[model samples]
Structures are given as structure tokens and as C-alpha cells.
Target: MFQTSSALIRNVHSQVADRVGTSIVRGDIGVGETLPSEMQICQMMDVSRTVVREAIRTLTGKGLVESRPKSGTRVRPPQQWNQLDPDVLRWRLETSDMDSYLAKLFQLRCAVEPAAAALAAISAGQDDLTLIRTAYEGMAAAKVNEKFVAADIAFHQAIYFATRNEFFWPIAQMFDVTLRQSFTIAARGSHRARALVEHNAVLEAIATRNAEGAREATNVLLKNSADDLVRIRGREFASRPKA
Candidate 1:
């Protein structure tokens, strides 16, 4: 009973935190603007003061807001945000324009994934190769969008694991949500066929222990994905009604 109640309280606290965090990220609550008073929040949200406080603390830990003795809690600037934090990343994607978000996401992926692929080519063991191959096979066999996206995420995740680099694992995990979003976009129409071929090139290079080949193949894959995204964005822009 005690554990269940505690779990419920935690859920409420997270709900409050997400509501406030989304507002801040969406600029509904502008940066540097103070949040409502604790009593006001408690009354407005119909939750206890403790829940509001805990929620604020959660936001503070995410670098979303800060509270001082006299000054109330205020939203932090974007530069101060922990962008790689999963919750923050989700919020940013929710609020950002699609094109800008895709640009930044691809830039980060371009910098990290190729190097990770090269490392995987050098360091992967039999088990690592098996895991990656299984994920690739999953992608190849997926008949629906949902399954394909999951397999694509698993494929990249396996490569990061194969790198045998502890730091790269967390970086790859941080990208989980963004990867799903991007993979869904890139997999639209006939692009899936081309993507599978590019993915095979990556798998083949890693399987052959060719570090440079893996790097080159990963770069080609990312470039093609970016090009697909641009074309999709162009089509959407063209289809939009004129102001």
C-alpha cells in the first residue's frame, strides 16, 4: 500500500513537471519569466504544495529553471539548457520548427555516428556483430512502419554498443526519441529501399572489419537521409496554402 501510494505521488510530480516544462520550452512561459507562486500552482493544478515543489526541483535538475531565496523560479535561457537530456530533447522537438530541428539533429548525428561506426568496425566481437546483424535483418524484414522504425533504432544502438566505448553508449541512448522521429520521416515512400542498401553497406563494412569503409558508408547513409528530409520538406512547403 505504501509503495503504491509513493508511486502515485511520483507520477503526479512528473506530470506537473512535464506540464511546466512543456510550457517553458514552447515559450508559453517565456525565458527569464518567473513561474507562478507555489500556492497558486497548487491551487491551479489541484495538487499539493509538495508536488509542485518536487516538480520545480525536477525542472531545476534539467536546467530548465532556477529558484532563489527571494526571487521566484524563472525559466533559463536555451544556452543554459541540458539539450541532450532526453526530456529536454523531447520538449525541444515538440516546440521547434521541423526543418530547423532536422538540421541540428542531422548535424549531431553526422559528427557522432560515423566515428562510432568506425570504432565498431575495429572493436566489435562476434556477439556484437551478431546483435547488429540481427537488428539489420529485423529492418530488412519489417513490413510496416512501426517495426521498421524500431529495427532502425536497434541497428544504430547495436553499433554504438559494438564500439566498446562507454561514453558513446550514453550518447546513443540520448538520441532514442530523435532517432524514431527521423527514421519515420526518412522511411517514407520508396526511400526505404535505398536506405536498406545503405544500411547493408554499413553492415558489410563493419562485418569485414573495414574501419574506413564503415566511416565512409555511414557518411553516405546520413547524407542520403538528409537529402530525403530536404526533399520531403520541400514538398510540404509547396503543398502549404499561401498566406
Candidate 2:
């Protein structure tokens, strides 16, 4: 009974946090705007003050809001947000303009991935190579989207780990959700075969310990990914209904 009640409280806490977080991200609660008072929130949400406080703490940890002694809690500017947070990433993707968001995301990937690939070529150990190769084989053998995406993430993540750079590891982790979404879009229609060849080019270059070749091959792979997204976006736009 105690455990069940505790679980119910946790659920309510999460629901409150998600509601407030989504509101802040969607600009319904604009930056610098103070949130409702704790007591007010408790009344509105039909939860205890403790739950509202916990929910506020949750949002604050995500860099969504800041509370002062007397002035209350206010939403922070977008620049202050923890963009890599899974909830923040999901909310932004759900609310923002897709074209602009994807373009900026790909730009970040283009800048970072090639350098990481080059470093991996220089630093990868035998085990690192084996892991990357295994991931590539999995990708090659995948017969469905779910399997392909899992292997694809593992393939890039292995390269990041192979770089042996502590800073690069978080980047590998950050790409999980975004890559899943991007790969799903890129794989639409008949692009998977070409994507596999592009991925193989990068893998081959890295395996040969050719730093410059790996960098160049990674660039080629990223460019093709961006192009695939563009083509798919265009097709989506063309197929939309006109009023």
C-alpha cells in the first residue's frame, strides 16, 4: 500500500512537470514570465504543495525556470535551456518549425561528425574497430526499419567511443533520439541502399586508419543525409492539401 501510494505521487509529479514544461517550451508561458504561485498551482492542478514544488524543481533542473526568494519562478530564455535533455529536445521538435530545426541540427552534425571520425581513425584500438565493424554488419543485415535504426545508432556511437575523447562521448549519447527521427525520415522511399554504401565508405576509411579519408567520407555521408531529408521534405510539401 505504501509503495503503491508513493508510485501514484510520483506519477502526479511527472504529469505536473510535463504540463508546465510543455507550456514553457511552446511559448504559452513566455520567457521571463513568472509562473503561477505554488499555492495557486496546487489548487489549479488539484495536487499538494509538495507536488508542485517538486515539479518546479524538475523544470528548474532542465533550465526551464528559475525561482527567487521573493519574486517567484520565471521562465528562462531559450539560450538557457538544456537542449540535450530528452524532454527539452522532444518538446522543441514538437513545437518548433520542422524545417528550421532540422537544418540547424544537421549543421551541428556536419561540423562535429567529421572531426570525430578523423579522431576515431587515429585513436581506435582493435576492440573499437571490432565493435564498429559489428555494428556495420548489423546495419547491412537489417531487414526492417527498427533493426536498421538500432544498428545505425550503434555504428555512429561506436565511432564516437573509438575517438577516446571524453567530450565526444556525451555527443554520441545526445544523438540517440534525434538520429532515430532523422534516420526514419531519410530512410523513407528507396534511399536505404544508397545510405548503406555511404555508411560503408566511412567505415572503410576509419578501419584503414586514414584520418583524412575518414573525414572526407564522413562529410560525404552527412551531405547525402541532408539531401535525403531535403528530398523527402519536398515530397511531403508537394503532397500536402491546398485550401
Candidate 3:
């Protein structure tokens, strides 16, 4: 009976997370809206308070909601969200936060990745360099152009691995997916040839152990990504259906 109850509790937690996350993403529970009280949620979902509490904790970790002593749980403002959390990132992508989110993502990259590349150039050992090179070569040899884009992503991932720092790796992994999507969209935009050139420039700098060059190359790569977003946004807004 204990085991059965535990399994039932787990199922309840998962269901609540899905429904709550969906509600938050769908704007049904807008930022700053108070979530249903524990008792209210328990009655609504027909679960015990323990299950509801656990689910709220899960959402809090993902930056979807927050709990205060007297105020109870409220949907967090965007500023308080764990933007680095993979689930949060996935939610943003699903909610089409791409335009606003991508800009900040580039801002974040500008602050981190170029410096990481420079560190890799100076400190990366044989395996580290090999990882970087392998990803670059994959980009170059990809039969499908889209696969080439994935290779480019792998190259940056290797650079993060070379940093040998735990704090940075997860953010690196999270953003890398969005970065790849952004790249594919941007690489198809106005400066395809130049974008490829920028990618090759980054690879050459890493291969040659030129730290300064690697940093600059990454900066150029991210700048182009931001530029491409501007173009993409313009086209999207132009085509958005009128209310």
C-alpha cells in the first residue's frame, strides 16, 4: 500500500507539473498572478496537499512560480526566472519568446562564450582540442547543410567543456540548442556566405591556438547572429496576421 501510494503520488506530481507549466506558458496564469492556494489546487486536482506542494517546488526550481510566506505562490516575473534552466528555455521557445529571448541570449553569449573560447585556446589539451576540431570537421563534412550547422554547435560545446568549470557547462548546453536554431535561421538569411566565413574563422583561430583571434571570431559570429535576428523579426512582424 505504501509503494502503491508512492507511485500514485509520483503520477500526481507529474500531472500537476504538466498542467501548471502549460497554464503558465499559455498565459492563463500570467506573470504575477497568484496561483491557486494549496487547498484550492488540492481540491481541484483531487490530490493531497503533499503532492501539490511537491509540484509547486518543482515549478519553482524551473523559475515558473515562486512561494512567499503570506502571499502564497505567485507566478514569477520574467526577471526572476531561471533563464539558464533547460526547462525554462524550452518553455520560452515553446511560447515563442524567441524574438525577445534570442536578443538576451546573444547578450549572454557576448558575455561568456568568446571568453571561454579564448580560455580553450590557452588551456585546452589534446582531447579538448580534438573535440573542438572534430566538431568543426563535422560541420565541414556534413552532407546536409543543416548537419553542418549542428557541427558548428558542437565546436562551441567543446569550447565550454575545455573551460573545466562546472558553473558554465549547463548554461552552455542549454543555449547551444537555441544557438543552433538561430544559426540555421540566420545562415539562411542575407549573409550566408559571410556567416560561413565567420565560422571558419573561429575554427582556424582555435586550431592555431590564437586566443585573441578566437575571441574576436566568436564575437563576430554572435554579432552576425544578432543581426540575422533583426532581419528575421522584421519579416515575421511584416507577415503577422492583423487582429
Candidate 4:
């Protein structure tokens, strides 16, 4: 979704929002704690008060902070945050505990993607199939981690579009950063060849209008991905001290 966005340069307001948002999510600015006043933030960030105010407004829209007339803006509780916002998700993934985040992300994928695959089998047009096939070919050919993850995200995004379901599109949109990181973690396994096999199964099933087969193939792909995550992290977990 953010593929064309600049990585090196951003607007002053977005830069401030990201900085403050990351701090809030990281608990560097605790819930209910008031942020510095507009003047203070302007001085601290070396931006105008207008920019600071706009940044605060953006954060407020994301449910990360709330502002009152006299009280200023304060960080909100975890439950109050818009957890599904891609920016919020990226901040949490950047600053919070990763194992917990990936586990939850996998659970969400398990719940959504198989159903999407089944729907795609029933609804995809030729163009959709072509897109999916192209992405799958990219995955099969990728020799580096970066290429693999990019191709992998494109492959799943193709499936979401193929489903032709409005609701599934938003769910797929949510996967951008989370999905890439998960695939990167899982890419080291010996499962890449098997992943290609599973991908082909889903692709072929959708191409043939085999809904059940498509769903089952997606399940197999996800299960193996989960297995890969655990296998890669197993050694690190094993070495952790018992509580």
C-alpha cells in the first residue's frame, strides 16, 4: 500500500507525528500523561506551533492521544488506540515486543486469508489470476530476502483483490508491514520450496474455481509459515532463562 511512499523524506508534521506516536506507543509517554504544551513541542521539535498542533490532531485521530481545551493532549490507554491503523501497527512493531505482535498477526492471518482464498476461487477473473500468477513467479524466482518478502506481499495482495469482496480488501490493506516482517522472519527455513508448492496449489485452485481446495491450500501455507517462525526462534527461546 505504501510502496511508492518516500523513506528518506517526510513532511514536518508527519515526522513529528511519527516521533511522538512512537514515544506514546513505547510508553516513553505514559497513558494519561499530558504531552508538552504546543510551545514546548514547537521548541523541542524545532517546528512551528501550527505544525505541532496539526501533528497532535493527527495522533488524536488515530486514538493515540486526546486533547482538551485547558488540559492539553495526553496519551490514551492501549484499548483506546486504533490498533489497526497501519502507522500505529508499524510503531508498535518498531518499539514493542515483537514475539507478541507476530503471534497475534499470525492468528489474524489464519482467520482471514483462507476465507479470502476460497472467495477468490469463486470470484476471480482472468486478470486477477494473471496477477496472482505473476506474483507467485516472483516468489519462486527470488534469491534474496528482500525480493522474497516483496513478492510474498504482492502474492497475498493479489489474492485479496481476486476475492472481489469489499470487506476482504480492507483486511488485506492492513497486512502491509506486518506481513512483510513475518515473511522475512520465516524466509530462512528450508520451507521455501514447499511454500512455492503450496502457493501453486492455491493459485491453481483459484484458476480452476475449486473453492474448497483453495481454502485448504491456504491453510497448509499458513501452517508451514507458522512452523517456520517457531523453528527459527526455537533456539533463542530455548536459551532463555526459566522464569
User: Considering every candidate listed, which one attains the maximal lDDT?
Assistant: 1
lDDT of 3 by residue, 1-243 (tens): 001111123377877776677668657788988998889888887889999999899999888898999998999877787777755666566666555656666767889999988877787788988888788778667767688777877877888888777776886688554676676766566565576678778767877889999999999888777767778767552343322
Q: What is the C-alpha RMSD of each candidate to the true structure, in Å?
A: 5.6, 5.6, 6.4, 4.6
- Residues 1-243 of candidate 4 have per-residue lDDT tens digits of 011222236898998888888778878888899998889888877899899989889999999999888888888899998887888888888875666777777778899899999999999999999999999999999989889888889999999989998878866777776778788888877888889999999999999999999999999989888778888987443233322
- Candidate 3 segments exceeding 4 Å error: 1-12, 25-27, 30-32, 42-51, 68-71, 190-193, 231-243
Would you list the clashing residue pairs of candidate 3? Answer: none
What is the Å distance of residue 12 in model 4 from its true position?
1.1
Query: For candidate 2, which ten residues in a row score worst on lDDT?
Result: 1-10
**TM-score for model 1?**
0.88
> What TM-score, computed on C-alpha atoms, does each candidate reach?
0.88, 0.88, 0.76, 0.89
lDDT of 2 by residue, 154-202 (tens): 9999999999998888778877766777777766758888888988888
Q: Which one is best on TM-score?
A: 4
Off by over 4 Å in 4: 1-8, 235-243
Candidate lDDT (C-alpha), each: 0.85, 0.83, 0.74, 0.84
